[model samples]
Structures are given as C-alpha cells and as structure tokens.
Target: MDMAETAAAVVDRQADERVRLVVTGMTCGSCSARVERALNRVDGVTATVNFATGIATVDAPRAVGPERLCGVVEDAGYEAAVQSGTAALDTGPEDRAAAALFRRLVVALVLFFPLADLSVMFATVPATRIPGWQAILLALALPIVVWSAAPLHRRALTGLRTGAMSMETLVSIGITAATAWSIVTLFARPAPVRGHGVWAAIMSADSIYLEVAGGVTVFVLAGRYFEAKAKRRAGGALRALAALGVRDVTVLTGDGREIAIPADELTVGRRFVVRPGARIATDGVVAQGFSSIDTAAMTGEATPVEAGPGAPVCGGTVSLTGRLVVTATAVGADTRLAGMIRLVEQAQEGKAGLQRLADRIAGVFVPAVLALAVLTAGGWLLAGGGTDRAFGAALAVLVIACPCALGLATPTALMVASGRGAQLGIFVKGQQALETSRTIDTVVFDKTGTVTLGEMTVSAVHTDLDRDEIVRLAGGLESASEHAVAAAVTAHARARHRELPPVTDFAALPGLGARGRVEDREVLIGSPALLDARRIAAPPGLRAALESEQRLGHTAVYLCLDDRAVAVLAVSDTVHPTAADAITRLHRLGLRTLLLTGDNTAAARAVAAEVGIDDVVAEVLPAGKVEVIRELQARGRRVAMVGDGINDGPALATADLGLAIGRGADVAIGAADIILVRDDLAAVPDAIGLAHATLRTIRGNMVWAFGYNVAALPIAVAGLLNPLLAGAAMAFSSFFVVWNSLRLREFRP
Candidate 1:
C-alpha cells in the first residue's frame, strides 16, 4: 500500500485499494446495506457499511474514484465524507453528534414529562381534567415531534425519496401517526359530558395520545445519543496509536551536530538520535549506540529487548537505559503501527454473514410491518371496534415493529472487539476470520520465523585449516550476499578476525549458496547440495560433520576451497520463548497442533518437539505447504495457518483462517486474516479466543433482536399492546444492543 498520510482522500494504485468514508444519516442496518448496494453497483467495487461505527469501507479498482463512491452513498439517502488517510480515527464528529442528540433529548424530556403527567392525572381522575388541557398537551407535543424528532423524520423522508424503507421510516411514521390521530380526536370529537365518570370517559374522545408522541421522540433521541457515544469510544485503541508519534525528534546532522525537527519530517534514511526515555521517531534500525527498548507497548512483550547497532525498532517503542542513533526506514501511514490500526478498522467496518442476513431481513422488515399494520387496523374495524380502536391498534403495530436491533447485532460487537484486540496487538482483517476461528480444530505453524526466531547463528565449526584462515575466506565471500546464513557466517568471522581478505567475482546462488574468488582461488560457501551440483568433493570426515549437524537440528553449510570442502559450519536458530506455552494453551482449548516447514526432517522435528506439537510436515516448499494444509482439511480438520507471512503466503491464503505473526513494517498487508503484531506466540491462541468471545456476543444479540420482533408483533396486531409501551421497547432496543456490545471493552482474551 502507498503511504497515504499526505491527503484527506487518496486514490491508491494497488488492486482492491481501500477507501474509507464516514457515512452520516444511517439509522439502521437497512440504511447501511442500502449504501453498500449503491456503492457495489459501481464495477470492481466491494463495500461494507458498519451501522454502529458509521464507517463504510470500500475496496475498489483505482479506475473507480473515491468521489464516485461518495456520490453513490449520497445518492442512497445518506451523507458521506472520505476519511483521512491518517491512522487515528477522530472522535470529534461522534462527540458532536452525541451532544446534539443530548440537547434535543433534554428538550424532548422537558416536554414529555409534563404531557405524561397530564395524561396520568386525567386517567386516574377524570373530574379533575381541565377544559383546555388537550390544547395545552397539543402545544407541548408539537415541538417534541417537529424539533426533537426532526433527524429521524428527515432521514425517513430522504429514504422515501429513494423508495427505501428503513428503521427511521418505521419510527417516523409511527410517531407521526400517533400525533396525527390525537390531533384529529382532540379537535373533531365533542367534549365529554359533565356527569360522565372514568368508565364512560375511557370510551370517549377525551383519551388523547399526545404523550405517546412525546415519549417515543424522547426515547429514540436517547438511543441516538447512546449510539453516538459508543461510536466515539469505538476506535480508542487506534486513536492512541495515532497520538503515539512524538511531537519532535532530535536528528544527527552530517557534521555530527544535533537538531530537533517534527517527527513526520524524519523521512526514511534520516539518522536520528534517541536518548533514554524518548520514544523512537519512526520505524528504523539502530545505526549506533545500544539500549534496552521497551517494546511492550507495541509487541506485547513484557520484557525490554536488547538493542544494539543494526537492531530494528518500532516508532512507538521507548528506549531505556542507553542512547541510540536510528536511521528511519518508514514514516507516516506506511509504518507497521499505522498498518495495524488500519487492519483493525477494516474489521470494525466489515459485515459478517449474520449481519448481512440481518440487513436483508431489515430491508424486508419495514415493508412487511407496514402491511401487517394495515391489516391490523382493518381487522379491528371488521371486528366491530370503532375507528379509534383500529387506529390505536395500527399505531401500536407501527411503533412495536423494530429493525434497529437486527441491524446492530453484528457490527457493534465487532467494533468493540476490534478495538480491544488492537490494544493487545491483534488485528482482525475481516469478519470471515472471526467466523472461521470458532471452528478451528488445528493450528499449522511454520517452523522458521515462527516456532524458531529465524535468525541464524554459528554454533560450531569444523575445519582442517587454521580457524582464522577458514573464517577469513568464508566471511569475505559471504559479505557480498544478503542471505540470513551469510549474515551469521560474516558476523561469526568478524568476531574471530576483525577484517577479511577482499573477494572478487562474487555471485549468489538462490536457495543454495554463494561462490567467489579469494586470494586467486575459487571460494564457495553454502549447503552441501551446492557442492553436489558443482561436482565438488567432500571427504568422509566433512560428510560425517554434516550428518552430525543435521541430526542436532542445526543448519550445516560447506566452506569450499578450489572445489574441495575445507570446512563445515553448524548454524542454528533459537526457539521462540513463548512457542511451548502457546502450544500448550491451544491444546487446553481442545485444539490439535502441527509444524510445517521447508527445513530438513530432523530440524523440523526438533523444533516441533520443543514446541510440544504432535505432528510435523518437513522439507516442504511453499507450494508443498499448501498441499499439507489441504490434506489436513481433507481429513475434516479446520486449520488456522500461522507464519511470518513472507514465505508462507500461499499456505496462509489456503487455510481456513490465516494468522500472520508480524515480522516488520512490510509484512501482513493482505496475506493473513488475523495479524499478530505482538512478537509473543501467545497471541495466536488469544486471537482465536477473542474471536470466540465476539462470536458469542454477536449470537446473543441476534437472538434478542429477531426474537423480539417475532414475539411482540402478534400482541400489537391484536390491539393488546399500548403505544407508549411499544414505543419504549422499540426505542430502547437499539441503545440496549449497543450497551451490550460495549462489554467487550474489558475482554482479556
């Protein structure tokens, strides 16, 4: 992905580049779905609108511009603004929205209380009712409907213009119907007889429903206020990330002078000096000095890692105990921290299978409710009930039928879970990962860079020549290469001999080794296979050394001189500190585990045994790794493939759910469904556990939302439900669902 921090709207050139828009006026899931449908109408566009967060994440071809997408959303009866390219999600709009709703709600409540108190007084004591009380109630209700309820009414009208029926539409019509009926009854019907008692007044026109109008408006406004508040809190984790960048950084000039500059101005390749207790300006490698870096904030490692020259460090990490000079490698949105924030937001804005179903049902729900309401009114009239009774029944049906809860059932939970996960360095890429995680029976791990630390170090060396002579020749040729093994060999050589002889004609053989000329003689360094391919000779002792190193689960490389193997180097990778504990946790959760790698059988098995894995697939290339995953799946295993994401792309994509352990800034853009930014392997099990928690919350919300409509609609149709009670249920459900989702903010797993 391109560095997108320069502008508010970025049209990226990559395929399926994401464009985020802050959508306004979305009242329910149907409204969000409508925006998705409109945007999806553009070719090569896929979009998901999260009703709770009000963020619409759209992946579209570069040819289809963001303007067109925003225009499409505006055409679908909502407002749209492109979200800025920065990782920090602004809560300003949400706060403003909540304040506005609260102000309106206070006004509605002021009017609603007086109107309700008047209705209760009249109900309990009809003789105490004043002659002009209805007129006073009418005056109070007018503002509650026209001002307090204006937002819903306006959105309802917008959807109506587009021939759409949303939750807003249903709520708006119910409020209007109740208020309109009361207006007609108050003016058209004769006043009650002077001697009439409470029983007689019950059947008369004295029972106006102005309080229902005021109460519904107040309740719906409360719901909106709560929704706005939740949205403001939904991205707290990313917002913190956006704020973590230092305000200023001290840079080392070419002349060795130190000067301070804005953090964003420290571009790639710029050398900056970081003192103890200062946060690194951006992602970079230490060019000088040493320190203990507190990476716990970014990588979730409880202990500070040792950092010396050439050690990579993230921007948000703090330097402890020493000073260091770092050369920036990434800045702005291109940094790993920024990418992680974006990954979590995309998940927050995505729709799961169940949410999509709810959207479909919400789309059908409003119109079905309209028909049912009409049938209810007609049925009441046919049963010899008066027009007052029929209108009341119809009004109750309109108020009781709610789709807001259904629309919110999934995205609210996801938004909360994504934010909480982000704080723990877990980034969920999409909803499919959450759904798939609930069923995963096995986890396939890559040995290199996953079970083991992936960095190679020479453990021992066997050679006929003097140690210094062999080291100088091998390190000189390896210096020209960039492979991990070459780095290990060069570092080992440097420690033994401070300098190496200059080499000529250096050439690297991919996946094999390197060859060059040192001191007018051919020098080669690589695996034993490179020698066999070159028709070189290895004596029995050298061959036996190779076998012994491989048996010990160490990488063995041959150092050759003039087509003859002169020495062998045994290099090994350190096992990750948390691999064993992570595997044990997965097993405790009733999951099977396997290690899949391209390393030789002995090496793979050694790492597997150390990590407590039950099975190992060894000597498998990237494509062969996919075959192993497929074989496991063919055996009815739901597998989640875990890797560093650089070499395991194919296997990760083919698995049921891909959890990519983040290696650096450049990894994990699109390769995995779940990105583990933390270096600890424990996040693997934590990701799955978090997925299960989110799934359970979503399921509970779905049942309540759908079940309420199923059980309440019948009572409304039979005229057994009161409009005030129905309005309370409908209006509070949306707020209740959001409040339920907020429980995930405290989730540990």
Candidate 2:
C-alpha cells in the first residue's frame, strides 16, 4: 500500500481502540462548540461536549495526546488541561481567574460611582454643555470601556465567530450600541433651530456615559466569575475520590526482576510486588504474601484489614507490613477506586427534580426577553418617541428581562449545599435530593441496622438431645457460612472449645437456612419453615422457647437431626444507639418518622416502640415496601425512604427522596439519591437541615435577582434614570444573587 493509505489504516486502527479523555476548561456554550470543532479536526478523533459542566470528553489517537490537545485549546485563546484519570474538584484555576476578575470589577464600580452622579447632573442640567467638560467626560469614559469591559468584548467576538450567541453578546451589543449612538450625536454639527431633539446637537458630558457602560460589564462578569467559582468548590468531592489511584507500580517480570512502571501500563493478570509501607498499584488478590492493608480510604474504617493469600486489595491501599506478590484483577478505570469516583461524579452531575423545573423555565426565558425588547422598542416609536427614547426602552426591556437570576438560583445553591455535605461524609446526588428532602413530610426507615443494630447475638440455645454435642455440631456446620446468624452460632461453639466435625454436601437455601451432612448424619439448621418442610417434630419445651423468642421479636433458628428437632437457637437485633435521638430530632423538626421491615409484625412493633417511631409497616416483602411508601404518599404526604438493602431498593426508588445508609447493601446505594456515608441515623436529620437551608438560599437568590429587575426596569424606561445609575443598580442586583447563593456554602448540616 502507498504511504497515505498506510497512514489511513493506522488511524483507523487507533480509532478502534481509542479511549476518550474527559477534560474540563470550557466556560460557555461557545467554548464547548469550539473545543468540539477543534478536536474533531484531528485525524483520528471524536468528542462530546457537556456545556453545563464545561467538560469535553475526546476520543483520539494516542499520538494526539492531551498535551497536543491543550496546545490546540491555548491556540484558540482559551485554556485546557489533561485530566489525570482522576476525579476533579470543581473549583480549580478557573476560580482563581474569577477572583481576579471580581477584584477588577470592584475597582471599576468604585470609580464609576462618582462618574454616575456627574453624568446624571450633566443630563438634567442644560448649563454644563461646555465642550471642554464634555471632552474630559468622554476621555475618562474611554479607559473604562476598553479596559474594564475588554474581557466581555473579546469573548463576544470569539462567540460570534464560532456562530454561538452568548450572554456576552447581549451585554456587548447593548453597551456598544448605546456608546456609538451617544458619540455620533456628541460630534454632530448643529442641524437646525426648529423642533430640536435631545442629544441631537447638544454635546453634554452625559452623552458618552462610558463609566456606566463599563461598570455594568465589569459587575456582570464579576458575578459570573464568583458563581462559577462557587459551583467548582461545591463539586470538588468527586475529584478527591479520583485522586486515590496509585501513580506508579513495581512490576515483577518473567526475568525474576522488578521494575518501576506507570500504573496505567500494568494490565490484568500482571504480577506486581507491593512492599511494606507501599500502596497497592491496582485492585488485585494476594498470591504469595501476607500483610495488613490500611483500607480506610475506601471503607472509612480506620482499623487495618488483615490480608493473606487470596485476600482482595484495592489500588491506593497501603500495605502496613510484609512483601506480597499480587495478581491484578482490575486495572485503570475498571478498578474499584475508579468505579467509586465515577459513581460520585455521575451522581453529582445527574439533575434532580427542582433543577429540571428551573431548566425548563430557562429554555424559553431568553427568547421571551428578546421578543419583549422588540415589542418595547416598537411601542415607543409608535408613540412618537425619538430613536434615542426607543433605544432606551428596548435596552431597559432586555436588561430587566434577562434570566440572570433565574438561571443561577438552583444549581448554585445545590453545589454549595452538596459541597458542605461531602465534608461531613454525606453525598447528596444533586439538586433533586436537596429539594426533595425539604419537601418530604414522612421519613420511612428500614428496620435492620437502620432503625436497629443489624447484629444478631445468640440469646438462647435449647436441645432435645445432649445440649453440648448438639451445639458443637450445629456450630461446625454454621462456621462455613457468612450469614450473621451463622457467625453468632459459631462464636458460641468457639467459646466452649468443642471439636466439631466437618460437613459435606453443604447448601444454602435463601431466606430459609443451610443444610449439610455432618459426621455422615444429615443435619439441618434453619427457620421454622425449613423444619416443617422436612417433617421434623419439635419438642413441646422447644416450641415454648420459640414462642417466647418470637414474642420478644427475636429470630429462632432450629437445629434438627434426621426427623427430630434437636435444638432451638434464638438471635436478637437491638436498636441503634443514636436511632431514638435522631427520631426525636426529626419529630422536633416537624417530620413524622415511620419504620418498615421484613420482620414479623410483633417484632417490628416492638422495635418501633423502643425507637419511638409513630408508624410501622411490618411483614413487608421487597415489593410490599413500595406499596407502603405509595400509600403514605397518597395521603398527601411526601415520603423519604431510608434503607440499606437490596429489598430496600424498590421502596427507595419509589419514594420522593431515598436516603441510603452507606453501610447498607450495594444495591441500596445504587438506588439511592442521597447517601449517608457515616451510616449515622443522625446524618438523616443533618441532611434534611442542609436541604432546607439550601432551598431557602436558592429562593433568596431568586427573589433578589428577579426583585431587583422588577424594581429597576420602570425607573430606567420612564426617563427618570440615566444609564449610569441603571447600570450600577443592575450590577448590584447580579452581585446580590450570587452572594445570596454563596450563603449555602456555610450550611452547618
């Protein structure tokens, strides 16, 4: 093949195996489009842009790496960086730039205040029409426009060139139109004496009003900067999770030598050596080593985990002692650490109910504002108003109707509240949970470990045969199982130091129990249902013990021989230490709490009373929980399901808001919109408080942003206000909205 054909073939091969680089830097929609265009131009590349988060993920040839991509972005007069296969905290270099912009904006505003007063006086009084004063006013306005508003001008031009209409477009067009109209009239020669128009031939210092124009630009830009910064800060939790991946690893080669290599270069099935005091490079299993791994990063439990052969170890876990050869099971983004980071980022990015409402409103807000401006201008001209009056009316309509406030109210507060939540080990999915938590009137809690400690302690053991022998044999069979009840049984036997025989043909029956052949004798350990199916007869005394245990809300497991019940073992679950206090706190906050469980009614009711819960739904299957939540919702109450189990998944997803106890089952976490990482029931109340605070702040921002526009629009259009004063008011309005949203960052809960 020819060289060109060979090059094309190589490009196709690279494209087939390409992995996208998830990048961040774009600030506006135009930036998104620009990045997409530039990346698509590369020989073997494809890209997708998310304007909301300003992230662009590009799939490209390895030869056209991230450094080359960053160069392309810089060349286009913007910024870009390679994501280090890690989660990114929202606040970064962009926040610093915003701070600098804010400082410049504040300085510009201070300078414009005095100039605003002078311009108003000059417009009202016809006496200060001196040419020298007008020249000085115009000259002073020049620096402010070109210097203070330069960023907006440059951005606007870039956006227009890329065929995208940005917020800067509206601001630049309004200010430039106003300034050009004033400058033309100021230098215009005397036209005539009859029916003279205002600003027709009169050269007043108010004509250029450059301070007013530039001040508006500076303030709006400042607000935008701070708003973006707040969002970045709020979203940084996921970035911290992403940074846990090990940077380098010690690869054990076939030559029996070890060499340092990048973690990304290590593939599945690779043998890597993790020395004492070194972190593991990937998710792997110990093959020829033993050590205690510090898993505090993933599990949040400070105690180190003992790992010998066949024990699992994740990337970034520190090996406290002993050398180990590990076989890599997962590498790169497939590692458990990477998966956790992905889940956090995905959960944060996912929109909740309230944000969807705001976005729908915003979709039509811009077009309506443009139409209103057009109508206002047309109405003014029809009423015999001059071009200057018509232009002023149109500008007022555009400035007042801008969705600047509406667009910011929800996401800004969510970012702030979620950021604060992360600090306390609570992960709120997004604005949806924030809004849902505030509105939920009823909180539903799962019984196991959520409302009660899931620990199953052995309460009593009874037998028809020799109690010691029965107990020993039962414990030996149970020791092989991982179930909670099995652990309790095994502990009892271990304490007695009884040598229990082994079991063969071991089988686990879901929700019923386990069975096996012990010492060539068939032994069955299970619930009453399992014993009934096998036609085992329980002794009268053992039946009484089972009844007593059931009445007290304890689980009774039966140990049986070939056809007779040999022993009765009971296990009881206790209420959590903090559960009662958390329930009381929720009640004080005006929320009603309920308990739902798969346990029998007697057991559920007993636990509910102990926890001081007013409502109870007992004997619920996984599907039955959904019905219970729906019934509560139908009673005009918003329900929040708090659980941590696969059975809880249905109810959690069906509720208005699902709060998952982080220590619960994986499926529970997967279905939940809010995760309480600390697994403390008290965090439930804390999350609720954060939600209310965040929603309150969002409303405050909306009221301030929209309220300012409503109050300022009439004054500007009625000719009672000059552009300088109007601009200042507008600037303060934007700043007020942003500052109000920032208050959510301080939410205590």
Candidate 3:
C-alpha cells in the first residue's frame, strides 16, 4: 500500500499495546537514558523515557504490567508510578515539585548575598579582615550547598552509581570542588591578603569559592521553577475545561417525567432537558425546542449557533434561550470535550525529531564535558599554570558546561505551543504534525463541507408527474444512498411526504446514483449522466432543466422510471460566511489553495470563486482525490489537505499535513494530523500560523542555547572568566531557553 493508504488505514493500524509510566528523580537527559536502558533490559519491554515530561512510554507484552515497568525504573535508582491513560491527571505532584524548587531558590538567594559581601570584605581590605571572617563566609553558604542543593547532590550520586553523567553530576562537582577548596583555605591556607585588583584578590591560593556554590544553586533552581510555572500556566485553559465536570441534569424519563440526576447516570438514547443559560448535559441530538448555544468554551467559536430538532450539541455548550429536549449520543470519556483534552495532552507528551536529537546529544555530551574539564585542568598544570589557577579554571569549566540548556531547548517549546494551540481550538496529534505543518506551501480543500457548508437543500424541482409523487419516489430511492446530493433530496421529501415509499432491490452506485423498485415501478435517482449510461435518453425538456441548473450553480438530480427521464431536482449548498475570510488568511501566509470535489465543474467553480480559491478540480471520485493529491506532491509542492473528517479520509492521509475541520460538536479521531474542533474554516489558517511561530521559537531557543555553551566554554578554559560569572551564566542559560519558549503562549493568528 501507498503512504496515503497506510495513513487512511489508521483505524485498522496494528501495534503492540503500550503503557505510560510517570517517573520521578530523573534530573536530566542522562538520567532518563539510564532509566530507559534499565527498563529495556527486561525481556519483553521497549521503553523511551522523556526527561522534559518525565513520562516513560513503553511497549511491552500483554503479560507484563505497568507496575512491573515502574519496578524496573525504581531498580535503576529512581522513583516511578503508573499513570492511567483514561483517567484525569493529578497536577498535585507537579505543583509539589515546583513548590520545592521555589523554596530552595528562596533559601539560596537569601544566603547568597551575605556570603558574597563577607568574601569581598575579607579579600579587598586589610582592616575588615577580622578573625573568623573567612569562616563566617563558609558558614553563611553552608545551608545552600548542603540542604538547598540536596537534590542535585542526590541525583549526582545516583548517576555515579549508574555509571552515567548528567547536568546534576557537573553541578554537584562544581559545588563540591568549590566548597572543598574553601574548607581547605579556611584552615590550611595563609591569612587574609589584601590585593590591588579583583583578580589579585580571588585568583590566588587564598580565594574562597563559597559564593559560587550558592549562586549556581540559586540559578538552577530559579530556572526549574520558572519552567514549572510556565507549564502550569500554559495548560491553564485545558485544565479549566477538563474541570468542567459532571453536573446534575434533568432527565426526561420514559414516561415523560423530568427527574434531576448526575449527568454520568445518563446513557445513550436517554432524553435530557437543558434550560436557558445552563450547559448541555452531554453530546446529544436536539429532539425538540429551539435555542442559541454559546459554544465558545468548547470550540472557540465566537458566534452562537441556533439549535433545533436534529441539531447535534456538545456537552459543555451553554443553552442561551429556550428549553431543549435532547437525546444523548455520547457520555463519559466519549464526549467531544474529553477527546479534545486527550489530544492536547497527547501532543504535549510527544517528542519532536529535534528533541530526540537533543536527548541523544545530551546522553553523550555530559561524559564528554567531564573529560574536557579534566583535560583543561591537567593541561593548565602541565603548562606551568600554578595549582590555584589550574583548580579555579577546572572548577569554572565544570560549572559552565552543564548541558541543561541543550536539554531544555525543544520539549519546553512544544509543551507551551501545544497548550496555546488548544486555546485557539486546534489540536495537533503530535510533534510530527507540527513539524509537517511547518513545511506546507499548498493547501487542498474538499469542496463539500470543507469550503462550503455540507448541508444542502432543494432549490428547485421540476416534473410533469404529481409533485408529491415525484418527491415520494425520488426520496425513497435516494434515501438508501448516503451521498450528499441524495441527502438533500431525502430531506426535501421528508418535510412534505412524511413517509417514503418502500424500496425493493435497492442498490447504491458508489459515485453515480441509486436504483430500486418503488411501488411496482422501477426508479432511478441520480445525475443525468447515470441515466445516459443505462441507454435511457434524456427528454429535451429534462436536458434543458439540467443545463439551467449548471448555469445557476446547482446540482441537478434526475429521476427515471421504466428507462424514461421524468423529473429533475436542483440541490444547492451554501458557502460558509467564514470561508472567504479563511482563504484570505491562507493567502496572506503565502499558501496556494485548490478546491477538489465530486460535484460538477460549475458548482465547484462557483464555490471556489466565492471563497477566493486559486484553483478548482471537479467531478473527482474518492480514489481520484488521492491521485490529485499525489500529483500535487509530485510537482514538489508541500501539501496540506483540508476536509470534513468522515468522507475525505484518503485524500487527507495523502497530503503531507492533513487538517480535519470539525463539524458542530463532533470530533474526528483519525487520518488527519491536526483536528480543528471549531466548525470554522478560519481555524485552518490559525493552526498553520501557530505551527510556524512555534517552530521559529524552537529554532531560536536552540541557537541561543548551543551558542551560549560554545562562547562561554572558551573564556572559562582561559581562566579569564571569574568562577562566579561562570556559575551565573550556567545557571540562567536554562531559564533563558524556557523564557524564549513561553513567548508562544502570547501567539495570535
């Protein structure tokens, strides 16, 4: 099968069962790698651990359980727990982790200033060098390097035992080397010496590095804390929606009595009542009453939609006026809101291609950094640099090259972008979707339901037979077919006939029409071309009727009885008001759009012109649609196919990026790379714009992070940079990466 066939077969795609575990105590990319290796050592388990999200997605045998996988990680010297896929996640653990980091930062900052002041006092002036002044500096920094920096120390020890290197290892070594030097200087070194310059004061054997220890701790904690806060705040919109939980709703019992009960107790086919200003209890089709529902909270639609009989309403939309009797279609986790939340969460958890490269680099970079630090210290001593100079430069190198910023570059940006995208009513399936969206230059739209509203109505009907009889016979034959034109005829007949004639020998032709025996007469309901194929000549008047509809941009449906054309029905579907605006926006992004459909050329061109589309390809079958997308790709166009979720599956899968425009209160779960929850064409541009911005942010962040290490390492190696400055730069580099990524939260299309 081709790529499109593979993608379109998403529902039938096969894979081993997967389990996700929430792991703890992983301090950096290396820690995660170690845990991953440990889990993979088990006989039937393949695992990937993501350091940014602390999630280990594992594929294992059915005999293996989640708890056992957690045990594997725990045995590798970390904490782990199973996170259920179907349940709501508890943010309590994340909150607690952030709070702990904040407390450590506060303690380190409180002590850091005093330690710096006392160290300067002991070194810069002879008069202020009182007895025990150096000891006092060490005492002030004691809590920071011990308690405030405890997590780093603990993780470093864990890494040592596992034969792995992490940022925590480099940081712990930097702090240890600095503190050990200070203790030795406090007792074994000479008394305080006043010097002429700043370098003369601290570059000698008598220098106290207590301040560097405290500063690094404060900076790393501050970066981690900021990242935690950004993640929580970025996801605020989704959390609030998820928290819109089950509430008491009035149910209309079988005997026509209303009783209040939890919405969870309501099942499919049960009728529920929604009063004015109240939220709909669940996903349902309106059985009675009329109302305008505020769907902004669920779908990000600014305008309200009028709901009456047969209108599908989402679970969380507010009923603005009139009481509604709705029969439930979905409940519990099957609701559209729940599916959206899950999609957003899944997107956040996915690791981008660049992020995986960063992880691989981090896995090896730490050990290489350790070796480089050793080489620098030894090289300095070999070149006649004194012990004081060699030790200081070595300590600086260790502190300056932590690799934390490299690890933070991509996943944090993806996390913020996913949450922000959700707020705009776009749900990306994964990082791969975002990556694909970034490259789209051509957008292909399915005309029906994509560019124009799919709902069609009878515009004009022509027949010599009794109008009622033609409507009845045509509607009966068309009802057995699920084509869009057939639906229009069926619905038009439904309003007048109330009951359709029973159809016998019913057979539906895929892209043509349907035929059956109705009330002892053979009936054929389809396009005029279908009649010609069966050796039935179209009467002159009926042929003129088809010509008139073609000129008027209407779909002409022909009804044939006993191999003679009898009547013609004209069906028209309205173009969405937002479609022109959506096309304008896509054009602004420098993208070309083409409208592809199975309708006649005139009808397709009319809708395309109304929407400002640049090209139109009409009279295409479902299989032909795939070939069109392939032809576009063969011309080197990076394509994004937009369609209604149900009928355009193959074409959607064929494009480089597939965007499914959602229906009112309905969510499509497969084929498309991105599913837009709003019933608005404008979401297409919004999604692409957001994807562009997110990728730009990620690229900028990586350049900054990699650039920082490249520039800072040389200065530290030369012993020209101060240890305190090295500590400060290393500490804030991660914070800078996260801050750059958070800018995506403010993105607007």
What's each prediction's TM-score? 0.83, 0.70, 0.85
Number of the top TM-score candidate: 3
Pairs of residues clashing in candidate 2 = 87-239, 87-242, 88-239, 89-236, 90-232, 91-232, 352-432
| Candidate 1 residue-wise lDDT, 172-235, digit = tens | 9988888887787677873443226654443333247788888888887887787777756666
Task: Report the number of clashing residue pairs per model.
Answer: 0, 7, 0
Give the per-residue lDDT of model 3 (tens digit) for 294-394: 98887778889999999989998899989999999999889888888788777866678887777777778888888888888898999998676788888
**What is the lDDT ranking, best to worst?**
1, 3, 2
Q: Candidate 3, residue 576: CA error in Å? A: 2.4
lDDT value, candidate 2, whole model: 0.71
Q: Local error of candidate 2 at 378, Å?
A: 7.4
Error of 1 at 105 (Å): 0.6
Name the candidate that leads on lDDT: 1
List lDDT for all candidates, in order. Answer: 0.84, 0.71, 0.82
Q: What TM-score does model 1 achieve against the real structure?
A: 0.83
Task: Kindly list the per-residue Cα lDDT of model 2 for residues 47-153, writing each as its tens digit.
Answer: 64444455556667777777887776555545666655443643555667677677667666666666555555555554665666557556656666667777777
List clashing residue pairs in candidate 1.
none
